[model samples]
Target chain A: MGVKRFIAVLPQCQALGMRVESADHEHVLFSLPFAECHIGNSRKQLIHGGVIATLLDTACGSVAVCALPRFEMCPTLDLRIDHLRPAVAGKALYCRASIVQVTPRIVFTEGVVYQEKGRPVSRAVANFMRLGAGKTPVEMDEALFSPNNEGEE
Target chain B: MTYSDSMAQLVSETQRSGHWETLLEQIPYAGFIGLTAQTLGDEILFCMEPLESNTGNPLLPALHGGVIAGFMETAATLNLMVSLNVDQVPKVIDFTIDYLRSGKMKPTYATCILSRQGQRIANVQVNAWQKDRETPIATARVNFLMHDK
Candidate 1:
């Protein structure tokens, strides 16, 4: 519901110039524009692997915020990122993250990144330690988490 | 410029600057991140200078998780490049990071251990701490594929 809440909350995310394409109770999408600083190898013209991970982490965190019943402290407990292929340069990449499971103390989510009409460039699964938001159980919205709910923006 | 061009430029800077910190500026992304490096005896230290552009949460005043990961990964890569005595960039194959604590708004430091080194791949374990080394803010293990110059 609060689409603007993310840009308003995390300035670093804003600084990364990540765009929130869509955010609703159903799904969350984030896109990061290519920048000179994002290039890992000026020769291969590849996007830095860490930058991809950062974008994916932010995307997952964004969904966690958009989907959580209330704003809470959710810090990454663990993050595993796999690069299927080098992220080609000169194209924006997108990530769609859905909360797979949420418990009183933890949140699990996974996402994939790719360019327009391109095969997945990378994939990631992350776990966040839920914090601060009191122990109220979060209601599970089945449709919001369905794997079919994914795509651009 | 190609990787070899950048590699040559970095090689000369190390020869002329007589300081490994020059690597921070030679790499475009490293310069953007504002990372600083120092050598104290046998230990190599990497620090992320606090700049407003790198803050993740202005509320907790914490360093962005991505920045922390980037910094740690950068540290590992650079250290591997130096330890292996290679001139080519190490491409990251995968990275696994654990956030032990919120990285507060301050200078954060990291040190890397080149755990396993081979002709084609290397593994580095990194520990990043904000205030106290005993209490690290985050830890990461990275595997990189080494390329020949």
Candidate 2:
């Protein structure tokens, strides 16, 4: 399955309005547009730290899965994030994640979230356990790669 | 009243009335995620009911890892706000989370314990559990920079 389809299968990605800007075996970049619902501090109009964390986690997970030869269920083992600065309000947020290392059982990834090119909002490092084939839900496979489901959403 | 004073008053009133909904109304993201909090004596318990939008994997139908992290962080921040009685929102500096188990599609609960509270920074450890309090699905350590007003 393609990376975009894989991301589309996840419900949280849909809920957050995450879109695939670019993806490949080497790295994946995702974007989330700013919305009023994402505001953590209404008075300051700042996006929530958790929203940034969500973006990092999603990016890291997607990149890890894409690194595999085939799509598999990759469950996060641990994740760490550092917020360098507040994300710019009323702008789209972007996260670029890449695989640091890959083993038979685990995939390590690192990611950074930013609105502008030079200014980073947060950085993340995470690892996911590579649950081999057959671990993923059969229904999910059908929903992801199925010819009938294509162009539906 | 200044912003700090108003925040303090809001917190005290919420505590006295045991109405956490009033406090949550101010946080848009918390409301968006369907996060709820209830005062448990001096402590607070945060909860997120299973919502379809929060699910990651279908079939086993687990909650998204990011959602779990978001819930825990949100809980910690609110817990800090109530504990410190501060006016400004605490800005997260860093967060580390360990996933012990998959967050099943069910009601998840979390509580925060202050690890340390210095003048400028505060460290909070959050534990999230479903089914039982002892077996946590995820545990997180969050450090925040306090901007006291």
Candidate 3:
């Protein structure tokens, strides 16, 4: 199936408060809102770092499987993140991730989580290994973004 | 001793326990420097400073899912110290995050509430919010493998 079709059938990113901002040939844009529950300070409010990682993880995963020519599967092997700045509270954070390179065996991408008006909050490089079609559903379910599945919760 | 001293002492306790040190390096530099821990009753209060560069939008900034997962991981690891009733490094077997709302781009807080701490395993729940606990940005249930000394 085409990447667009696959994403359409997949479950909504309800838990992460994920919203699809835009998608193109090589890049994707997403957004998440800031609420009272995420506040950590009164003076210079900000969002938590963990939340940023989750967004990057999901975004990178989406980038990996989108628009492939064959029926190949992919899974995250490891992800590394570096925090750069503080995302001020009450302001939304934007993520701009691009697929830097993709090979037959691995997918590499660089993502940046930054404020709308300021410098980047964090940057990440993620690597995902391609899984063969013979893998079981349980194995595929853990890493691959299955449309009808909510993952191994 | 003063409050800051007490906090310093508490951090030392956490640091000496090797619990904080183990996971501190595991998180991205942004998360490690942003997260803070404190003693709260039988649990630990973990604090986070949201980075503007990490949110979804500039107009109404919010936290991302990956960031929350990292924070949850840290919170769960720290809580293992209390849940296992020991100060040692706990291995996280598996973790799940339930994003409730768009985490505000501000200082968020979470507390590790140990549900069960057995000889070999520990379970904890972490809740995070910006202002009111009612509107949670994310919620998580973590399982850890505890090998205490």
Candidate 4:
């Protein structure tokens, strides 16, 4: 449940082409690049709605981990996504998730995905149930991300 | 136009052409996850074959949570695509998914209902199940911006 450890265990994210763009103590950003392999409908050249849903789920889950008082894998209780627009093909989409609330048993978070700056394409909210036994809270910064300097990568 | 009229027209077109099956086959992610489409009279059925590649929790042997979400979302989109008989993919306006249960290592089935349509937007609901039609593992609501033909 240490904030950063949760992001490290996501093999599914790698399979779907999502990478972390930024992360701090309370907020995390994820980016999903467009690829032919991930396109939902080829004729229309749209990124699959399912891919966006995956991104929203992971981003929201990351927020839950960040909000956790200790390191425990929070199970997703529920998730909701609203597609604001069709994700245009050939552009990488971005998402940023933040913790909305944290109760002892559950965590609430919201996230938004977009291609262009300031224009959101989709948004989602999720709830994660905290586990009873948690690992000791550790320094999550070093283990959280791949080596990419904030402005450089 | 009445809902019945449009529904009848879609059934006729898809029955003759198998448009939904073809579209599901063409999508890359759909193919990646082994998604298949079957038309049952007025309903479109989406199926996912169990595979090691699609597994997220090896310990539980459950399908990845994302895969289930993706499958249901694709089912909802394809439902609208075939029903409206539209040329372009309907742009999703929003989607809400409720994961009622974990999808285990077995074939999963889904169906979608085109709940409402306005001039520019449409709403769809999807139900996914593993064992019984009466019980669903997940439910989703997807809103789309219908394209101008």
Best-matching candidate per lDDT: 2
Candidate 2's residue-wise lDDT over A24-118, tens digit each? Answer: 88799999998887888776788888788788888999899888876688899999999998875699999999999999999999999999998
Candidate 1 vs candidate 2: the TM-score winner is 2
Clashes (candidate 2): 0
For all candidates in order, the CA lDDT equals: 0.76, 0.87, 0.61, 0.75
TM-score comparison, 2 vs 3, better candidate: 2
Q: Provide the TM-score of chain B versus the true chain B for each model in turn.
A: 0.87, 0.93, 0.73, 0.86
Tens digits of per-residue lDDT, candidate 1, B1-149, equal 86677776785565444487656554566666678887666567899888787887675677888888888988898777665556777778888999999888889999999999887889999999988889999999998888754
Show the lowest summed lDDT stretch of 10 residues, model 2 chain A. Answer: A136-145
Scored against the native two-chain complex, candidate 3 gets a DockQ of: 0.13
DockQ of each candidate relative to the true complex: 0.65, 0.80, 0.13, 0.42
Predicted candidate 2 versus true structure: per-residue lDDT over B1-149, tens digit per residue: 87667777887777677788777877888887789999888889999989898888766778989989999999998899887777777889999999999999999999999999999999999999998999999999999998844
Q: What is the Cα-based lDDT of residue A133 in candidate 2?
A: 72
Off by over 4 Å in 2: A138-153
Cα shift from native, residue A86, model 3 (Å): 1.0
- Models ranked on TM-score: 2, 1, 4, 3
Q: Tell me what TM-score chain B of candidate 3 gets against the true chain B.
A: 0.73
